[model samples]
Target: MNSCPFQRARSPEQKAERRAQILEAAALFFAEQRFAAISLAAIARQSGVTKAALYRYFPSKEALFLALYLSELDAMVEAPLPQEGPAWAAISELLIARPLFCRLTSILHTVLEHNLDESQAREFKQALLACFAQLAARLQRDFALEGDQAIRFLMQVQQSVIGCWAVSQPAPVVASVIKAPPLDVFQVEFGDALRTQLRALQAAL
Candidate 1:
């Protein structure tokens, strides 16, 4: 096996590049295959680094996975929210354009299904909640929703998004699982139902 690229100290630029490569490889691997089936050795090989080098950057597979997960969260927060439209438009744009939102949900589901340790699981939950809270705050501020109603609405939206993404059915079966009377009878509709629900909330408010 090749050594980890991070095993030796290098210039800041080189180190940054190597870490980015490892993260890129990890993300691709996670997306392409089951997280439980992937091994650190495979990641190291995919990254063109030895196990030791991979370890130097990420001490274990879990650490690497968590790092990737956190990176995804950071990306979501840093991504541009729609600036030129009403709050609802901005929220819709964010839901549709932010790859990290979906990716993070997918990762969280994988971690939960695979039975990660308590600490890891808790961290993932906290990160997910934090993302939701950030979205809720933004909505409240930009849309002028206030008080308990805003909080309740945010919670509902958060749950709706999580339910939409975290469910494991094939695309065709998602509608049955959701079973909302007004939702269209289609599976895996991406942002459609969420947008509709949010629009309803806006209309009510």
Candidate 2:
């Protein structure tokens, strides 16, 4: 018997649940559409929450998407980096298997992070640094590298993924043009480029 215009005020647990529900809906949208093209209103519509209620949890669409990105980053930190087989293939396989995560990586720094406020940005970056530390530790365990060296390698691989995703993901016309055998030299498959870069890094190390 509680009634409010936007929605009844939520308990802390309910708030967290609502936040997660919004994130799940937003993830599906991001998977289907480009990150820059999606709006907060669309996300709220998909999540079945009013815009005001959604704002209560996320503050902004960028913040919400950043949360999704960070969640995926945490999962990556937990998952072991490729130990056996071609390192490039392993890296590409891992990224391709989680296409949404891979897609968001290309926009996280430039678009999503750029729109956030200082406080929110700091909070997210702090969590990211922790994830990076976890990744470095994991890499050191599996590869013959020092802590700093492991972090350097991981950072390079991260940069390669972002760059490759950007160059390889194109519009329909561009993609069609790139498919021609003569233009193959200009064509770029993100996973393949990522894999090649990763393999080179592995070879060096």
Candidate 3:
């Protein structure tokens, strides 16, 4: 017989707690494994819910990941950046410290958004645009970037993070090869590379 560790959550509070549990489990799984390597079944097991029950909160693995990604982004947006540093530097530091956020960001458009239905996809875009607007406001106020320029700077930052993250985390075979002398030149330090890109983008702005 199958064990039922997570019952059907009934109350609104219970549902909220169950959702948090699922997201926490998903976040931990993402931290230790590549996104492609994880499954809804695995996340359900980790969260102590059946795969069927998991759907009560998240429609799909992509949805689950998207939710976690959005939560991470929301937290980042809510936190204030350091006052002493350049905005780009502070932004780079914030992103680099959150490995799961960086990893998810790298695969966002490629993987996370791939399986979403139209409504889910639209919601995700809306949320992201809101975040960008908030960030653009920060750039205008703190960094003296004008309206469109602030938006452009934010776009450049996202591009740099995605590009740098991809280069920094290659396939296992490529990673091993990069450990050797000449190939070592190809290795990317995420923070340094991202910061450099951000600095260059700011200079151009």
RMSD of each: 5.6, 3.5, 2.5
Report the lDDT of model 1 for residue 11. Answer: 94
- Distance from true position, residue 147, model 1, in Å? 8.1
Q: Please write out the lDDT profile of model 3 over residues 1-205, one tens digit for every residue.
A: 1235768889999889888888998898888888889898988888878899999789988999999999898888887877777878888888888888888989888998998889999999999989889878887787777989888888888888899999988889999989989889999989999999998998898
Q: Which stretches of candidate 3 lie above 4 Å from their native place? A: 1-4
Using alpha carbons, what is the TM-score of model 3? 0.92
Tens digit of lDDT per residue, candidate 1, span 1-205?
Answer: 2244435548998788778878888887877776778888888787777778888887667667777867766766566666565655666667667545455555555453254577766876687667656766665666666655666775665555666665433444664656675554544565776677677766666
User: Which is superior by TM-score, 2 or 3?
Assistant: 3
Which residue pairs clash within candidate 2?
none
Q: Which stretches of candidate 2 lie over 4 Å from their true place?
A: 1-9, 80-90
Candidate 2 per-residue lDDT over residues 1-205, each given as its tens digit: 1123345346888777677778888988887887778888878877778888788878888888889998888777666567786544555677777777878888877888887778998999898888888877766666556887777877787888888888888788988888878886778877678888888887776
Error of 3 at 77 (Å): 0.4
TM-score of 1: 0.64
Q: Which ten residues in a row have the lowest lDDT in candidate 1?
A: 1-10
TM-score for every candidate vs. truth?
Answer: 0.64, 0.87, 0.92
Give each model's whole-structure lDDT: 0.66, 0.77, 0.86
